[model samples]
Each structure stands twice: as C-alpha cells, then as structure tokens.
Target: MLLLLDTANLEDIKKGIDLYPIEGVTTNPSIIARENTNFLSRICDIKDTIGSGRMLHVQTVGLKADDIVREGVYLNQLMGDNFYVKIPVIPEGIKAMKVLKSMGVATTATAIFTPQQVVMAARAGASYAAPYINRIDNIIGDGVKVVEDISRIISTHNLDIKVLGASFKNTEQIHKACLAGAHTITAPLDLVETLVNHPLTGASVEKFSIEWESVYGKKLTYDF
Candidate 1:
C-alpha cells in the first residue's frame, strides 16, 4: 500500500520525507490556511520541497460544479501535471470530477463515508476515493468495515479506482484500513512516526547496538 502525508507544514513534511517512504502530500484548505501565508508561494514551496515527481493532492473549496472544475483546473496549472485535484463527493463535486476526468486531470473524491460513495466516485472517474475512517467511527463505529466493503466493491466490479483512507487517530486504525484493503493512506506525521516505532523494536535495536559496540569499539556496522 502507498503512504502519503496529510499535511502542508513544510517542516513536518521534510522530516516525514527524511524518515519515511512517503509517496506524497495531501492537503485541504484548513491545512493550507494554517500556514497563514501567501497561498501560491506556499504551494509552490511545497512542490519544490517534495520535488516534481511526487504526487501532491490539493482540495478545491468551490461549492458549485463549474466553479469546482475551474478551481481544479487552476490548481493543476499552478502545481503541475503530477498534482491530484481533490474534490468532495457531493453531487456538484461528482459533476466537477466528471468534467475534470474528461479533461484528463488526476482527481480524488474526498469526504467519503461509505462504500456507495466510493462506488459513485469511481463511476464518476476519480483516480482515488478518500474515506474518513476516524470520522466514520466517531459517528457509526464501523469505519474499517466501510473500508473493507469499499475494497470488496472495487474488486468485485473491477473498478479502476483505489481507496485512500484518511482521518486516522492512531496507527492501529491505519493497520485496520490496510488489512481492509485500502490502497493508500494519508496520515499526520505523528502517526507516521508511530508506524515505524515500537518499544520492543527500539529495545532490541539498542541491545544489538550495545553488544556490537562491546566488540567493535563504537564502530558502526558500515564502518567495518
């Protein structure tokens, strides 16, 4: 499964990249607004930091179909060809998605809550459908089941779309999403760091290092 960082903070993003094999960064208006800086310059700086080859998913705030499409196109022009324009899964958003898909732009359907929405977004030609896992669990208590159902639907219908699970509160939710067949997940940096660490793993590594140093006089394995 692919992993992406759901943040726009450059410092966290740089650290995330240095620490993990992050495929890209995903951002909504709230994330962008937190910087409280020039929008274009901030996005451009993000593009520069992540480099041109990585995927950058940016959401559109437009509420109308036409306006959403326009904003998506504009964002594409601003970011570059590799950018994925994220739209909501509302009626207007689906319409905008169709229009954007016809124009050959990579699109992601966001704010999804069910398998039906995932199927709708895929039918509307979204390259990825993002389901809010923690939000769904907060309201209904079966977020992982929803992701699994979406995954089953994708496989049963042979849809050319992937589930992008988001809004995670912890690494266990991430693990459930993956086991439920989410093709990708976008999470905060803290959770991403958690994914790489465990008490046993750290203790084992420390023990191994101590034993090695006892014999090698503080030399790293590579130095030998």
Candidate 2:
C-alpha cells in the first residue's frame, strides 16, 4: 500500500521523508492555512523537499465547476504532472473531474463518506477516492467496512481508481483500513511513527543492548 503524509508543514514533511518511504503528501485547505505562509511558496518548498518525482495532492477551494477546473489547471501548471488535484465528491467536483480528466489532469476525489460517492467520482474520472475513516465512525458508521465495500465495488466494477483512506485518529483505524483494502492512506507523522514503534519492540531492543553491554562493557559492537 502507498503511504502518504497528510500535512502541510515542511519540517514534518522533511522528517517523514527522512524516516519513512512516504509516497507523497496530501494537503487540504485547513492544513495549508495552518502554516500561515504564502501558499505558492509553501507548496514550492514542499515540492522541493519531496522532489518532483513524488506525488503531491492539493485540494481546490472552488465551489463551482468552472472555478474548480480553473484551480485544477492552475495547480497542474504550478506543480507539474506528479500533482493530483483534490476535489470534493460533490456535483461541482464531479463535473470538474470530468473536465480535468479530458485535459489529462490527475484528480483525487475528497470529502467522501460513502461507497456510492466513490462510484460517482470514479465514473467521473477521479484517480483516487478519499474517505474520512474516523469521521464515518464518529457518525456511528463502520469506516473500515465502508473501505472494504469500496474495494469490492472497485473490483466488481473494474474501476480504475484507488481508495485513499484518510482522516484517521489512531493506528488501529489505519491498520483496519489497510486490512479493509485501502490502496493508499494519508496520516499525520505521529500516527505514522506509531506504526513503526511498540513498547514490546523497544523492550526487546533494550534487553539485547543490556546483554551485549554486560558481555563487552561497551554499547558499540565495533569497540570489540
């Protein structure tokens, strides 16, 4: 599965890139606004840090189809071919996706809460469909199950789109989403770190270190 960092902070992006095999970065308007910097400059900085080869998904702030298309074109021109414009799974967004698709601009359908929305977005030519996992669960819906259903629907319909499971609150939610067949997932750096660490793993490493130090009176293997 492809792992993506869902943030707009350059420091976090750099740290995540240095530590993990992050495929790309995904940013919404809220994330971008949190940085409180020039939008174009910040996006450029992020692209420089991650390089042009990696994918960058940026959401559009347009509410109309024409405006969304214009924004998508502008972002495509700014970020190049590796960029995926993120649009909401609404009527205008679907219309924008169709126009973007005709122009060969990649798109990710965001703000999704249902499998039917995935279908509509995919049919409209979205390269990816993002579902809010924790948000769905917050409303008493089975988020993981929704992802699973989306996967099945994709396979059954042979849709050429991926499920980008998003809005996770914890590692368990991420794990479940992966198991539920999420082709990709975007999460915060802390949650990504949790996936790489565990108390048992740390304890085991410490035990090994103690045994080695006791035997050699040094922590470095090269010292011997």
Candidate 3:
C-alpha cells in the first residue's frame, strides 16, 4: 500500500517528503491555496522535491472537461511525469478522465461516494478512485466498510483502477483501510506517524528508559 501525504504547506510538505518515508503527496485546492498564491511555482517545487521517486496527486478545480484537461496539461508541464491528476466524479469529470488517461496522464477520480461512482470511474479509464472516508462516516458511520466494499467490487470485476482511500481523520480509518486492502491511503502527517508507531512502541521506549536510568545516567540523543 502506498502512503500519500495530505498537507501542502511547503516546509511541512518537505518534512513529510523527507522524514515520513511515504510514497508521495495529495494536494487539493483547499490545501494549496491555504498558504500560497503561486500555483505553478508551488507545484513545481513539490515535483522537484519529490524528484523522480514518488507520485504527486493534485486535484483540479473546473466545471468542464476541456478546462480540467487544460489544468492537467499545465500541471504535467509544470511538474514532471510522476503526477496523478485528480478529477471530480461528475459527468464532465468522467470525460476529462478519459481524455487525460488516453493522453498518458494518470487520473484519479475523486469525490467518490458510491460504489457505482467507482464503477463509472473505472469504466472511464481512471487510474485511481478516491473515496473520502471521513465524509462517508460523517453521513453514515462505518466509512471503512465503503472501502472494503469498493475493494471487493474492484477486485471482483478485475478492474484496473485502484482504490485510493482519502479524507482520513484518524489512524483507525487508516488501519481499517489497510485491513480492507486499499491500494493507497492518504493521511495527514500526524496520523501517518501515529500508525507507523504503536502503543507497544511507546511502552517499550518508556520501559527502556526506566531500565537505562536504573543502570546508568539518563542518555540524550539529538541527530539531524
């Protein structure tokens, strides 16, 4: 499973890129516009930081297929190839996804609330389908079930599209997504760290600290 970082603040993004050991990033308009005004510059910086290693998923905001395709091409030009274009799950979005995919741009059909929507995106030749787990839970509990069901549908149909579990609010959702066999899951850095570490790790650290102090003075470490 690929771990996708959720924030786009430059320094925070760089930290996530360097320290989190993740697969890549996912940025929406809300995330990017939160701090910056230079969309092209910021996107290029992120792509450069990621270099040729990871996938950067970016959401495009537009009402038409041509508009979204333009955005995708601009992003492809600004960033390099390892970019995943995120399109909404509307009629125009499906069209845009097909065009973008045919043009060799990886397309992620976002805002997927229903398994039927997932089917449509797959039919449209999308590379990935994002189901907002937190939003699904906000409407009806058991958001993980959605991922599980979608995973089953995609697998049963043997479709080429992958399920990208997003909008995760906690490690539980991340855990459930992993258990449900999602192809990729994106989360904030805090949640990613929380999942990478467990309570057992904390308990072990605390226990080791106590034992170390008993045998010798407390040890300190600071490394870059």
Which lDDT value does model 3 have at 15?
79
The runs of at least 3 residues in candidate 1 whose Cα sits more than 4 Å from the true structure, single-residue gaps closed, are 219-224
Q: What's the ranking of the predictions by lDDT, best on top? A: 2, 1, 3
Report the C-alpha lDDT of model 2 over 1-224, residue by residue, as the tens digit.
Answer: 99999999999999999999999999999999999998888888888889987899999999999999999999899888589999999899999999999999999999999999999999999999999999999999999999999999999999999999999999999999999999999999989999989899999999988998888877465645
**Residues 81-119 of candidate 1: C-alpha lDDT, one tens digit per residue:** 579999999999999989999998889999999899888
Model 3 residue 90 lDDT score: 96
Against the reference, the lDDT scores of all candidates come to: 0.92, 0.95, 0.86
lDDT of 3: 0.86
- For model 3, the superposed segments whose C-alpha errors exceed 4 Å read 216-224
TM-score of each: 0.95, 0.97, 0.91
Per TM-score, the best of the predicted structures is 2
Q: Candidate 2: deviation at residue 178, Å?
A: 0.5
Superposed Cα deviation of residue 47, candidate 1 (Å): 1.0
Looking at model 1, residue 127 earns an lDDT score of: 97
